[model samples]
Target: MRSSDFCIAGGGIIGLTLALELHRRGAEVTVVERDIPLKQASQAAAGMLAVRDPDNPPELLPLSELSIDLYPAFLDRIERLSGQRVPFQTTVTYQSVGHSSLRPAINLPTGLIPGDDGLSRLEEHSLDPRQLAPALLTAVRNTSVVILDHTTIESAPPAGCLISTLGPWGAPPAAPRKGQMLAVSVPASFGLDYVVRTEHIYIVPRLQGPRAGQAVIGATVEDAGFSTHTEPASLARLRGLAAAFLPAVADETDFPIVDHWAGLRPYTPDNLPMLGEIEAADPGSTKRFVATGHYRNGILLAPATAHVMAELLTGEVPSVDLCRFAPGRFGKA
Candidate 1:
């Protein structure tokens, strides 16, 4: 039996980041991932570090702010360890109000700038998850971390306190959500330096050297189970939304199609992540813990989550109040 101090399931950003943190704190960690790190939602994400005043939930703001602040240092540490530069830009994001009566004018501060045309400023700032994920994985791997790919958690460990980071699982009946997304290649002339968001559309720029001139546009939330299938209907809906917000892309012939994909974002009734430890079956035992349910903020909250998890594992008091995100908060009432 493979043994380690900690075993993390789902190697995406959150799992990998936690692995790195655990390793940094001198704990041996084994990560079991179902697929490649960036191939899932972590790669498909537009990498927006948003905190729109309107969208910010009072309970989650503190955690969000803490994560945002730790990003710079996080990136620096990853780069130093992996020797790869992760691009992070403080661009202005805009939220264009459309004429559709379906929704009202909504503005929010995002960490990305809208490069497409005809979008008004709502908020902006940006980070490249594509670059960040690989950088982090590389750093962890360099430290002799073990990651088992294409492995699923058929069943939780029978003994150690099982901490479920599985986004869609809670208590008993699990409800997983699926999201769709697309990647398009744009010419160097696109000149879109900011991330743009409309009532239902968002566009982010590519940060890799090879795809530097392109942009990744997408993301449609659906209740289609945990399947990551990119259906034509969803792609059409996304393209239509993009064209409406950026009139310039209305001509399909002018824009080059690159890639299309989809992923699952774990959702819960409260939409807040689950964190903390589980008491061992033996009444006085304290052996297992969890830091999951981050949903979409998994990337943004990775650093803080790692820090908190490390504190828990080391018996050190965490610097922040975890009461709001306590895993037991959602226990059966």
Candidate 2:
């Protein structure tokens, strides 16, 4: 039998980050994952750190902003400990409007500037999730956190002070929404330095390595449960959307379709994460905390969620208000 003062189920970013925090506070920590750690939603994410996203509801803006503010420190710590380049690049988001439509004068939010492409340019940031996962995994491995890969944890309250970061597979049932995306190579003069988003799609440019000039075109949100299949039709639609935003990308058919992939986002009914303690079936049982249902913001919110959960586990009040994310908020999760 495995034992630890803190056993975290699901070693995605949230689980790993929380485990690191708890271990730093002198707790024995073990993380159990169904597959390789950081290979799930954490790795598949596009890593857009958009706090003041045009679409974010006002109620959740503070948490999102807090998480974005916390990212710099989080990335620095991981880089210091793991010695891996966790790429975080500050960029702009060009929210595109349809051609021929009269451009409405938008009261641009803070950090947003008017753009030339019939779009609003919002100063934002992004990182490569592919790089982040490994850096986090490496950092945790350097610590006292025990990671059990390829191990499925089945028992309820799996261990003492259990924290479930099992996205889409935990209580309250976060449904898996699949998204299809594709990456294409870019020419030297691609003239694209920022992310571009329409209501239906987003094009995020890559910053480093061989794919440096390339950009990722995504995604189609479908209510396909846990299915990671890359649909050609969805990819084509994404490509079409990318073309609508950047006409140059469509003109170059020979750049080569670099990669195509899909990932399942954990979407809750309320679209808020479940945090805090689980109400034990038997009142006398030990406490089990949950931290999941982040949907598309998992990458953006990991630091704050880990910090909050770590604070709660250590018998301290979280700096951030979490009343909206209480585990039992959605009918006894």
**Candidate 2 local lDDT, 136-163, one digit each (tens):** 9999999877898877766422467888
lDDT of each: 0.67, 0.79
Residues 223-317, candidate 1: write the lDDT tens digits.
88768778888887887777655656555666666778776776656777766775456677536566766666667777888887778766899
- Compared to the true structure, candidate 2 yields what TM-score? 0.90
- Candidate 1 segments whose C-alpha is farther than 4 A from its true place: 1-3, 34-39, 96-124, 150-163, 169-174, 279-281, 284-286
What does candidate 1 score in Cα RMSD to the true structure? 4.9
Residue 104 shift from truth in candidate 1, angstroms: 14
Q: Candidate 2, residue 149: CA error in Å? A: 1.1
Work out the TM-score per prediction: 0.82, 0.90
The deviation in Å at residue 141 for candidate 2 is: 0.6
Q: Candidate 2's C-alpha lDDT?
A: 0.79
